[model samples]
Target: MKKETRHRATIIDVAKRAGVSKSTVARVLGGSPNISEEAAERVHAAVSATGYEPNHLAVGMRSGRSGLLGLVIPDIANPFWADVARGAQDQAAKEGMSLLVFSSDWDSAKEAAHLRALRQARVDGAIINPVADNLDGLDRFGMPFVLIGSSAESFPDTSSVGSDIAQGVRLGMDVLLAHGHAQPAFILGPKSKLARARFLRAINQHCIERDIDPASLHTEDSDYTVEGGKEAMSRLLERASKGRHLAVFCANDLMALGAILAVRDAGLRCPEDVSILGFDGIPSGAFSWPALTTIEKDGRKIGSTTVTCLFDEMAGRPEHGRVYIPCRLIERGSLANLLAGNTDRLAAGR
Candidate 1:
């Protein structure tokens, strides 16, 4: 067989076509600021014409900037976290940077290990959603980094991009209260400080705004899992004696779906026996039996924006700031207006 010939373009070809020195081409490729505007235009024109892509590894080695961002997430399997990762990944790629991810699995040891690895790799920056309560350990890390999703209020040294969960909770509660739910039940996540703090702040704020007693709102904390939601809901159903129609707001969608099942298991119907609202608009939540009413946290936006923030930080720009992505409420059939009859059924399972 004849030797296979590749048609890939090289930097020399671009340099020749642009009538610029190879050094100029290298500077342009490395995003060096010393290059002139006219030279950059010519190099860009040549690049577009030849479809030439620079070798990232070679460029990184020369510049001493790996152009690599290390992203550490608490739990990759959770749809909420998945959204965040996706956003960060897309943004990093858009900036011509690579993302190196490490799943902490909600384990502190694993998180610490990942941080050490990132530092060992000498990454340009990190975007970490810390697994531990305080990421004080990361302070010793010399690389630039941003915190995504979760924030430790006590530790304000790092930059972050996160959701306004308190706002999400407030919105969910407002919708429920407006629908005539006098007493609402909360399905919370694990004992993370941020989770607990968000719930407490939102509940207090909502109660004050609605002129309702804070003690009237019922709360149950569990792991950020479907089973946790189920167990927590079961306990709430037991306490929901005297035919009181409960409006339940879950911390996350998985828990909300679990609560929906628990409500059904308790010989009650959703939006009929109770109104259910969930957080994190995971796609599965929309396809659940009754279609879950949830707060849509734009994971795509969060992920992409976090990457942008990380890149900005890496550039030594004035970007040490916190970004809060607003939550949107998706109205589904799960929330029922106060009526004496039990009605509504889940859609066919996907």
Candidate 2:
């Protein structure tokens, strides 16, 4: 015996069962305020009786809105990005929309491909943390997009949400200088990113203002991972001068944690022998062996704000331009007062 295939119920079936026009059913499903209560009740009753489900794709085709948002980031493994994704997801849920997140792993080609996929998926908008400053194909994709943690120079008209990198750097430098360190070494990220460039500029400006020779400041680039931080910190230790206390500032918390380990491997204690600071304010920093002092960028707030900007753009609201979130200094045990004279001599140099 052959089994009969059941046909799926559509909005038309519900409308026919309810003895109402298709337009009335559409308005009821779309939650139009203009729909009368009697019509809405009939549509709901018919929908239940017919077991009809709205096809989101068909609705989107007619309405030009998919009720979906795409979020693209470099690395999802990083705790900072994880927090960012969570925040964005929460906000999207509150707005009656769904979020689709993608990790590009810092690959420019992959990032572009993800953008294309988002367009094909008909996402209402997108928020991207680009792999690099180049966004040549973004405008041609014909979707409204917001940049997160990126520079305004490349896409000046695009909306963005990020912390003030210069202010954060200045705050960290002030803390180091207050502790009697004339010049602090830097564990910076790759120069291709705007964050690193802004940080480098801020550190140089800070040194110059304090009458410290900017050239005297030791700097090393890393891949923004704990291992990369460890390697960079180890190299800095090998070349450091003798009889001087060393203060270091890392681009992010993961790097700072690795730097602390490097200090220990070199037979030096954090704060007592070497002072370190980091950025991003990741939660793990608070629970590390020696709590990390960092420039708090508030990834959650940045994510939520980016979503808000994208929603506003989708609603045809006036563009507010770039939004700069302020960064704060979170002082913790990782940084020590060199002025207290508890510094110990290092085996390598100082």
Candidate 3:
């Protein structure tokens, strides 16, 4: 037998149930303060009774706003970006707006496509970590937007938000210094990238302040990944003087985890043989072999604040400017068995 179709409740049904004009029901549902409280109450009751739901498309047409926000990020799987997306989503909900999120996977073409799609959808605003330097597409669309991530710093005139990378590095280094690990090593990004430049500048300043030789610092270039970090760490360990409290700072938690693995792979104990410090306070790091000490960048704050900036742009209020949120250092077992006591896996695995 053919199933009978169910009719969806409409604004008219709500108006009829409330015993008010359709315009009055519309005004009440649209949150117009001009509507009488009595009328609004009746309309709300009628809406519940009739199971009335407004057509979002129709509402957008009437208000000249889609009531939607767009986000385009480098990697959805990365825990940092995930937190960012969550923050933006939460903020959007508070303002009665919907969020549309996309991951560009570090592809410029894909990034461009997502931006175009946002324009086509007529999103009220967007937050993007741009993959391409050229942003002619944004100019053409005229949709209000905010840039996010360390790369956002490159666009000085754009409204943007990101972690204070240089400050975070310095904070991590200071901890190393206080702990008497004067000549700390590093697993950094490739020099061709902006991230590497920021890291180098911070490292140089820290060295200069303490009268430490910049040339004496041992550093290796690696992509921001566990495997890359492992390889870089392995090379650093191989060439270094044999075993005397070697400390290495990783660009991110994933790389730090990799470094830990490399030490273990070489039959060396973490913290005892080498101390590790990381950036980007991913939640998973807390549960690592030894909890990873890190410079914690507030990704959620970056995301939510970016949304706030987008709103300002949407309203044509604040002029464009970059916002840098400060990062804090979290010390744990990886900094040499000080905080989190660890059951040495490298020894046990043997």
Candidate 4:
């Protein structure tokens, strides 16, 4: 094969184009606040002209702060995590930083591997939603890391940001109760984070207080996907019997959409035959048929807050403890009176 030549530009090119010393280019890339405004503008113009993307690896080797953050999660496909990723991305970009992402798929071994990889990448910090509660391996790494949405049996000095799902679930339950739903079926995702479990327990407790027998409450588990929600709701309906007045609360909006599909396929009407409630008010939920009634969490706020905490650590501040992100409920048309006409008619002909 013939040799192929590729055009590559370096910091020297940027400095030459900007008519500045190489040190000045380096300082600009390092985000030195002391750089003069006019000088900064010239360096930015030169950088754009030369299309010189810095050698981040070499920079990381030279300085402990790589201006890079690593975010590890289970699934990017999940809207909840997608929102989390958005938050991290927004925060990173705002701080003139970049991010490296890894999905552990709920596997400890994979999580361990990513942790080691991030260390080698010399990231400035990491925000991880651990696959499970195995913090021993992470604790031993002794790096600047924060946890998001999960915790361990014995955490050793880590910062965390997680949704208050317990409060969220309680709020959903209270909303359903206010809307005259006495018996609502529950759909839970398979992930067993402390927050999720707490929400589950709170909702179950709420049922008890409402005189619902444990056996009478329909419940099922899924893999936290839209398809999983659909199948689980199908199973719930099969076991609970048809024509029974019911409401459904899903662990997430994706699941709620799935359940809504299942309910409609069964020729039952949402909010009419069964009111549907979901957690994590993803944008898609709003445009969903009849509009989904769900809880909304400020994902961008969480992301920005997590980055702020990470910066504190980078600045040599003490490691942080847990941080809680509040949740809110949004009532829409997905929830309706039990006696209302078949929502199938409203949902149909779409």
Per residue, candidate 3 scores C-alpha lDDT tens digits across 1-350 of 99998889999999999999999998887789998889999999999999988988888988899999999998888798899999999999989899999999978889878989998898999998976544554575468889887677777888889899889989998898877688889999877667788888899998999899989989999988889999999999998786356899998888999999999999887777789999999998999988999999999998889888889999999756988899998888888642333324443444
Angstrom error at residue 238, model 2: 0.7
Candidate 3 similarity to native, TM-score: 0.90
For candidate 1, write residues 1-350 as lDDT tens digits.
89998789999999999999988998897789999999999999999999998876676777788778898898888887887878788888878778898899888899888989988887898888877666556667678887876554345666778888778878888787777776787887766657676777888888888798988778899998899999999999888865556788888899999999998887777777778898899989989879999999998888888787777777788865678889999999899876333332331221
How would you encode candidate 2's per-residue C-alpha lDDT over 4-24 as one tens digit per residue? Answer: 999999878998988899989
Off by over 4 Å in 1: 1-55, 339-350
- The estimated TM-scores of all candidates read 0.81, 0.86, 0.90, 0.84
Provide C-alpha RMSD values for all models, in order: 5.1, 3.9, 3.5, 4.0
Clashing pairs in 4: none
Model 4 misplaced stretches (Cα beyond 4 Å): 1-6, 14-48, 152-157, 191-196, 208-215, 339-350
**Least accurate stretch of 10 residues (summed lDDT) in model 3?**
338-347
* Winning candidate number (TM-score): 3
**91, model 2: CA deviation in Å?**
2.4
lDDT of each: 0.82, 0.87, 0.87, 0.80
Candidate 3 at residue 124, lDDT?
95
Candidate 1's displacement at residue 107, Å, is 0.9
